[model samples]
Target chain A: MTRLPGTAKTPGGLYAAPSLVWLSVFFLAPLAIIVAYSFLTPGALGGVEWSPTLDAYRAIANPTFGKVTVNTIIVAMGATAITMLIAIPCGYYMARSEHQNILLMLVMIPFWTNFLIRIYAWIAILGNEGFLNDLLLSLGLVDQSVRFLYNRGAVMLVLVYTYLPYAILPLYSTIDKFDFSLLEAARDLGASKMSAINRVLLPNIRGGVLTAFLFTFIPIFGAYAVPLLVGGTESYMLGNLIADELTKSRDWPLASAISMVITLVTTLGVLLLLRANGTSVLGGDDHEAAEPAGEADALGAAR
Target chain B: MEARKLIDISMNLPHCALRIEDGSDSVAGPVSATGNGLPRGRALQGGIMECGGAKKKTVKGSDVVIEHVRKSFGEFKALDDVSIDIRKGEFFSLLGPSGCGKTTLLRIIAGFEAPEGGSVLLDGQSVLPLPPDARRVNTVFQNYALFPHLSVFENVAFSLRLKRAPEAIVKARVSDYLALVELQAHASKKPSQLSGGQKQRVAIARALINEPSVLLLDEPLSALDAKLRQHMLIELDSIHDKIGITFIYVTHDQQEALSVSDRIAVMNSGAVLQIGTPQEIYEAPATDFVARFIGETNLYEADVTAVSGERVDLLTAEFGAIVVTATNPPPAGSRISWTIRPEKIRIGHTEPRAARDGINVVSGVVAEPIYSGFQSKFYVDTASGAQLKVIKQHADWSDEGPELAWKDDVWLSFSAEDAYIVEVRR
Candidate 1:
């Protein structure tokens, strides 16, 4: 068949060729190397050798590594949960507000500052004799400065603060597209204001919620800088473990293996979340998921 | 604002005063079964006082009395002291052009928009303090607004679910309402999957499943095509008949209001110009705006040359002297406005020889003839250089290519009763 230029029968793949090639060169190739290294022996000089072994995977089963994995999961989940809790209301207000441009700019203003500098700014406020401690001392609220930084809580706080805009932007866009008239319909149908928002508004914007969760959770799962700068020994997470193995211990295979585990955990978490919500990851169109109706149906009957 | 109120009061005073003068014996009518003092009188000439035929059930609906309701947004007054007494089980319409505050009044009644001043009462109890959900009023929004995330069955069952009804009851009631709107088969489908008419039906089912005391429909059929609009109107009327709940319908379409409403409140510029039956609104409009808004009419300003017994002689600026009927004729030599419907003016090639008793005839040449299938409209330019529109119905086979083409010499005539005083211009 004689085909015109740019009109091939299966031109979708051809159109995607650039991204495919780029991903292969820059992303997938690195990922493949990491996977290969995870299965290979670690060389003496901080690199993988030709001999293959399951030594790195066996090291991951150590209680120390296990403790870091669990700690990382807890921090990631907590930070994401808190970020979403703050983001949802901010998104709703921005979406419904008349000064949406200003609110959006305010939400995005944090991004203009460098991420590390912003983290440092948080440390300056939360450190011993920081702004908060100085204020407390001036107000005579405390006799001594509180040790607010260098802990798991500090890592979570910084992670949440950093990732909040990521959650808010997707949420705001989805909510702005939502038909607000449905909320009125819900109220007209005898639902109080709160119930209307919960049943109608939340379910309708669940796609945005999922997007916000993944956006916050996945990044916080692999958060390196926040933990490194704000966290103490008790707050050493998976990101810190991978960094320690790669740089200090020079266990290249172990670092690659831990990176693979983080990737696996995130992918599996995303898949489970999508399945639980009965939504396809690619088909996260706002109206595609109708699974929440089950809870509404049950509630209707119960009510 | 003070001057506007004075003008409003002066305009509405005559409507009630004239009805009292007619000796219809219902000026202060007995309270309806629903206990609302709705003044169920034939308030204007040609106003139909009786309710619709046989299908009407007992009054299970709430009486909505919106009194002196005023609201504004920034500098724009959306509703200016708008007051309407919607009777129980009445298919009442708030008819006006866009931005005339008909939808705003409906929203006020639905508890969606709070008024700056005034009280809205349901069954003689003030409902203004109650939230929309606490009030027994449900609205079928303009765009349907069916929850996109919910299936048709769940959408219909939403209210019952909120009340925590039994599972079987919710199921049965949802099915019944879905059947009422004829979407029982599509209950499992999402609202996005439905056609415009079907989506509208789902919205109707959703709102009506609650069995609200009053149903507020805000331009519900406006999104549908012409044919579907007509069909949905009929379906809406039937549903109203079956339910017998008070329906406060808001629309810009006059024909829809005229065909469906037992009473219509015609509004303009955020104020109600007139309120009466469709016949009263069409034949005996209280203002020049109502005459122009309700339907097509030939409206003109004229000097009242003489007035005697029910016949008023008016001298037009161009068409010369014309005689019209008015029960309350104004003083002689005062400038006034008058209107005659296009269909009321008969056009013929020669002089009208039938009845000259109360008929006024004017000779003119056809200026513009617009021929639609069912009727033809002719803009006739008189010998004195005034234009008049005459609509001739093509109800028979002989009307198939009218003999009177454009620029044809024609004579137009109408009985004095057909041409009524629109307003006495100040």
Candidate 2:
């Protein structure tokens, strides 16, 4: 076999060396240090102690930590579900629309501003004396300002809004590559409008839907700012709990232990989702069996 | 062979005679007439019972009558007052270059598009108001449009499953259609795994399983390689024969249209210029556009100088006087255009002794000679400085013989009947 330039045996490894070194220095080193710190005792002065202990691991069984974990999962799942409901249609329209680029630009326009600024802008709209309340009051639909902000509902809404683009972009990319003629083919083959979309459109873009779900769900699960700003004490999640453990409580070992648990759980969740989607996170060889029965050919023939 | 058998069976059926007499002669008769003349023999054999078949059975195919249909996309008119009558069981082709509205017309028939005006009648009932699913018309999209997620069996059974067909019935029908397309072995394969021709066959099988009265194909074979395309064309023709359904095929390739279509409508700029049987379209083109678009032809602009009983003498700019045969001669002094196919012109080294009156002969030097495997095209520069193309077929297998090289003096001759008059288009 002819050796390609820069891809020959030793040179290929040499080419990858810099990225490997960078990842090792930035990621592996930090992760190793965190793992080491997770096992050690907390210093009195908010620093690491050389003495080892399983106290941090034992503390993970606390009811408060369990509640925080449950709350985090609930909020993430809620945000993902709501985002998908809105994003699928939005992505489908953007993919099929003639002015796709303009629509995509509009979807991305929010990203041009600072993320925090946009979040604050939402505060102005959803606050007690905000635009929604003022409009409702002027229309005589409400007797007084309702508590729309600083609640679980507010946190979910803001999370969904903030992560809507993540869901839409991946969905749009997959849907855009979709051959819409399949829908037409379905319709032509004696399928009703809705049946055509359900049978042809949804199944074809399952990968994109899964990708979008994971993209939004993982980040929102570990989100810090959205819950901190919008959520009340009752809505405290794993992110807030971890932040409190590190800052207010100044318990570095327990915090590190909690961080490791979160990392492990998130990684496992992502792996399971990826496995269900028939893709691999670490670039392993794909294991999905070839789809049986050529749908297009058989459909065309049937028609 | 299968087509001939199908024709025989259909001809023997008692109800076939009435179908022939119900104005289907113009479309159906000519289709079989052009295809090996076997259908014509079968049609004639069944003619004895023509007057007395009681109980008209429902025909297997649907008749499409597009009346005064017009469609526009913004400022651009895609179809302008286009009308056509596609007979049941006829392979009709809409032949045109790109952007000539052939695909648009097919889409309208398939109910993927709606016309701005007029109505589309299928089997004497207006289908214009119906959605695509409600109409008994299916389309084989240009790209096949196979669903990547489903298997071949599911794709073929999509329509049946939608109608909630019994699982056994769906399976049996899907297998039958797949077998028809010779894709039974590939029933479990995905579309991505099949070849282009295989995918096309699957698409045909899918459309056919719906049992549509009319099947519309939108340039379905344009994606295959040349050899595969020819093979698939034959397969498509056989499928049409087997089903005996009206096939409204759209194509830009003239040879493909001529090879498969019973009748062809040549369109340009959203308007149909001529509609005729393949032979009629080829041997006697109605207009200059049809003449040039169908095949290669040498066209000359001439002024009619004299008109005899069946011959018209014309004065051309390059060739002084040329006599052409026309049953009804045009008036003298009228300017007209005439076309002669390159194949009609005989090229030889010396003047032929059999040359007769009304047969024109011109001597010219071979400007260029291009030798293909089966024929040679010679560009002859006449004494008047006008060049004419002549194609001569090589009947015998020879590496080199009867060669006419560049600068060789050659004689070109054509009978008056070989030159046809084409209407001058402004």
Candidate 3:
């Protein structure tokens, strides 16, 4: 076999071999176990039986599973849309402002605290006897404390709040790499301010926007913690159902099948997103989708 | 001599009419006489012509009149009471080092920046109130900021498309412009696919397709390598020649400004030091800044002692009692400074027997000699510890020549006509 210059047989492969081994051991092996569990029949006790059957996959067609799937899609899509709407402008400002480091630091401040603690803190602020209701009641703006927690609105608010930083970081990276001079050039060529942003600024940073959308959407789709704490019965999603099947009902086969279905759906969604953006998950050659020549040189040379 | 004098008089007479501060009837008379038409003359006199009419005139370009423009950003005065007049169809350069407001002035004319206290008149109409999109001007930005997502054809067609021109007309015009820049074959390719020079050509084509009265170029060639920059400079001049539109080019490169500009305004510290033709700016620079900024020169502080019709004798600390040619000499007992370009000075192995009336010579020892292919530069240290630089062109290819090595005594001679008197600003 011909040895490449930077692989083990060449230098590069030798360097990359450790990470490949790690992924196979920690991720692929567990995933393979899950797939096998989904195909097996349940045991008389809590373990799986040796016989293979399609009963777990058939159970996925139940009406409750259908409701959970639709609810998950709604919450995930809503949170993704709302988070992105706020993140795009926030990212643009963070990237273009003179005080970019300070703004970025502020965006990252919430990440320093634990994720579960931050969601709980939101509950303290939004609950009936919490800070907001107490302030409103004292100010005579409300006759009584309103029920703000344990609702769909509370779940969505917390979901958008939780994933906002994820959206902004990727969006900022992409928009920050954009050459601001393109906007000026567009205006010089007779484009109005609005048209310039629409034509030049938005199109150039579409990759970042797409990346931000997918980064928020995927995690929110399988979200469980925030919904359990703040969401009411109507807000229960697929993640809640999966937990119920695995723990309360002890139906490992059915839970594994649902988990597999969720994974398949999310994987398809990611693939679709990447395809629409003309990018490959593995980052193959896409000439039209590549960064502009000057921008690439500017960034590469800077590094 | 009389015929030459008559030619000089005739040349200056028309310019005299143009130099009228009020810009009244005398200006119109000569402008009309030059076949610019009576309507343009009346418009020029009134300073109230429509921008469209101005563009349609046979003159083919708009005149830019900046009247005492002053701009400040917080504490730093970027443009301090600066004024200039760019004639129609002229390739004018705003030449200065960084932070000298050359770029700021170009931006103000493009309506990207608004001055605090001056009016910018384009083709005799004030454009200060107009926004960038409304103005009939386009800029070729410094980095050739072509849109990355668009094809080369779409980038060139951008302005026409914005105006909602018909599809057929837009296609034909865009293709024509692409052919002009020699990028028709690469029209479908994105900007990321082309080389640096190709990107710059696309930028130029995009700016020109608008057919603005004045095209602003903000150091458009600074990003390229030396070879490509020179090649592009030639192409830019030819494009300007063919289109005959006024070009306001901004650059800090003296060679670029000198090689391409019909008139150049040399700026320093947010102020214009001098404005003139290339020869006038080089041969008769108005200030010490202009003299030092434009080229290499040997400057000397001297006291004027005698003035005798076109020749002034000065007492200098270094070279004693030097005589210089000056049409307007400073009065006796006044301190002055004069500059002699290195290329103008002649180096000799031995001193000549007699000095001519308009010639100044000084004896010095060669401090250093640097020899490139075309010329040799010698730093000669005089008796008073002043180092005067001199350049000698290697006209003959033969290596055989009178060699002046380190510490060799030599004499430098230069004519009074070559030494120019510059103002010593406090």
Candidate 4:
């Protein structure tokens, strides 16, 4: 059947019905509920009350909440930085390697196991009497079993492991689509091998790097199970704070407010990522963003 | 023209410094360190000098000497015992069909591929051990691999940035090179936004900004349409003239090689069949494959019947007899092959005159006449069943359509000097 020209704003919107319905029902509705509850008063027992109040937002400004926010940002940023450092080389290798299918399969194999099960597996490997401690004892490397579990480092480690694949996949796709001859061109133009990768390959694949960063950082920012399973007393995060607010303190409005904060931060990050990647995805950009502050530096030199 | 003047003035100082440095024979400079013995900084500084028009016209370019370069990919021989000495500042070409080792040779020279056993020298200095980055050479890749993320200005300014030149110098040089390529208006545009021809110009400008001694072009015009390819070819030639650097171009298109190259090396099946100028390749091809590949021609295998002073008579199975002129005539009773171009043979409607001293005439019936607007090509079947192709040009208005129709009795005559012996079968 032919469609009327002006009736539908987007003719392809009909094909997008499944995703639209799924997001509205499962995502947007819950998000709207959380936003509404965040601005209301908490009931005496658990649920939010009908009376409107700003107590939940006022609680977020406290010093204890400020510490948790700082801790969460540190864990997310540190883990994301380490994951990207490893994933860049891995993605480059997979993109250029002849055995791409095998490498891709290996990258995806971790997702086959349950998330909590994998965190428990890390515990088994890193515990005081675990396989690593046993091996260290047998090798006479340590006089006593090392306490490798229940620390902030452990939480960051598990977070990195959980989100490594999310970072690798996008980086791999972008590196694979890159024209490798540009590297050769860079080399032919007197660039060192390292310089070629930094100046040409990295800038060209900026879209993938941004996507990988968002993919890992957003998930690691809202991480719950890994930190709960592997972390010690000092490793409390926004996700655990929200969980405690809802379950232990019986504060529904505070939990919704915390959740709203996480969602707002992540949404801002995603918007920023989309803006950076919109032109790059189409293989066109102003390219002035990546340039060094040469003019400013020159002016400084002049002075 | 302003770009040329700027290049000349900027190129002079670096060149004088290079000459003094070369005299000192210092091959251990930090900037020039390579596995190769010679200092690359000296060569790169030498490259800068070659970009100057007036000074370089006297100083000349580098001599590329390839000595017995051999390469193999698994069981397939990509380049086999190939060697050529390219002159300074020459526009040389490696002409061949697909998979004929032309590109392989160009890659070896560019330092992208290492030969199994050989050495390449630039101006009497070994460059085989130098990496692509160390070698004083650049390539205009076949696909025009302009950096997609970079604007036209940044792409051309890449080498300058690597050298950490002053920002003002970088901008000025980039603008000059862009003006040299007639792409000043597109300086801020990214490579993806440019058309195929425009991208090609960007690639050229980017490569030329480095001022390498030898510029290697691997079929740089193959991506463009016919009319655009021709236009770009002219532009490339003019660029070569303005720069006066050694150019080693690789292409499978015979017309492009013939029209642009100062000398051409015709290759086939990983072997160099012949090396000559366009006229020599077209008129006196070394072998049957060369004859067929260069242009349209009628080739026949015949047994030599007699040999005289600069003249040889031969008898073929299809055609009864034929006479041709050869410098070193083959002995009588030997099998040989010869070729004559279609345009060289004259076709007439009626018998005109007696056969001259060097003219060989034969009578045939027109089999197929293809009238392409400017010229007419006729395939004539002789009485003995041999077909000879002849072309007639329509120079005036009166010679418009087919002057002679199908099955018309026509006389085809060509001078003995027009035919040349291509092969002598043992």
| Stretches of model 2 off by over 4 angstroms after superposition | A1-9, A37-54, A279-303, B1-59, B395-401, B424-426
lDDT of 4 at B165: 94
Best by DockQ: 1
> Candidate 4 falls in which docking quality class?
acceptable
Clashes counted in candidate 1 amount to 4
For model 2, residues A1-303, the per-residue Cα lDDT tens digits are 223456546777678777777888899888888898889999886768999999999999999999888889899999999999999999999998999999999999989998888889888998898999999999999999989988889999999999999999999999999999888899898888899889898888888999999899989998899989888977788889888988988888898999899899989988887786674322321222223334444333322
Q: Could you give me the TM-score of model 4 versus the true structure?
A: 0.86
B258-300: candidate 4 lDDT, tens digit per residue = 7777678999998899987666788889999999999899999
Order by DockQ, highest first: 1, 2, 4, 3
Kindly list the per-residue Cα lDDT of model 2 for residues B1-426, writing each as its tens digit. 554345434433445532344645222321122333122222322343222221111235788998888999999999999999887767899999999999998888878999999789997899988988999999998999997776777778789888898866676778778878888878777788899999999899899898888999999999999999988988887677556678999999999998787679999988988987776788778888889999888888899989888798988887789889876678888889898899999888878669998888889999999999889899999999988989988645742346788899988999899888787432
Candidate 3 chain B, which ten residues in sequence have the lowest lDDT sum? B35-44
Clash pairs detected, candidate 4 = none
Docking quality (DockQ) for each candidate: 0.33, 0.32, 0.28, 0.29
Off by over 4 Å in 4: A1-19, A276-303, B1-59, B352-354, B395-402
Indicate the worst ten consecutive residues by lDDT in candidate 1 chain B: B35-44
lDDT of 4 at B335: 89
How does model 1 fare in lDDT?
Answer: 0.82
Span of 10 residues, lowest total lDDT, candidate 2 chain B: B49-58
lDDT, candidate 1, B1-426, per-residue tens = 342233223333334222222222222332223312122212222332232112212345777898999999999999999888887677899999999998888787777889999999998899988888989899999999989877888888899989999876777677667767777778777778899999999999888888788999999999999999998987897677566678999999999998777689999889999998777889889999999998899999999999999899999976778899998999898889999999998788878778676788889998998999888889999888888888988647653345778889987889899999989986
lDDT of each: 0.82, 0.82, 0.82, 0.82
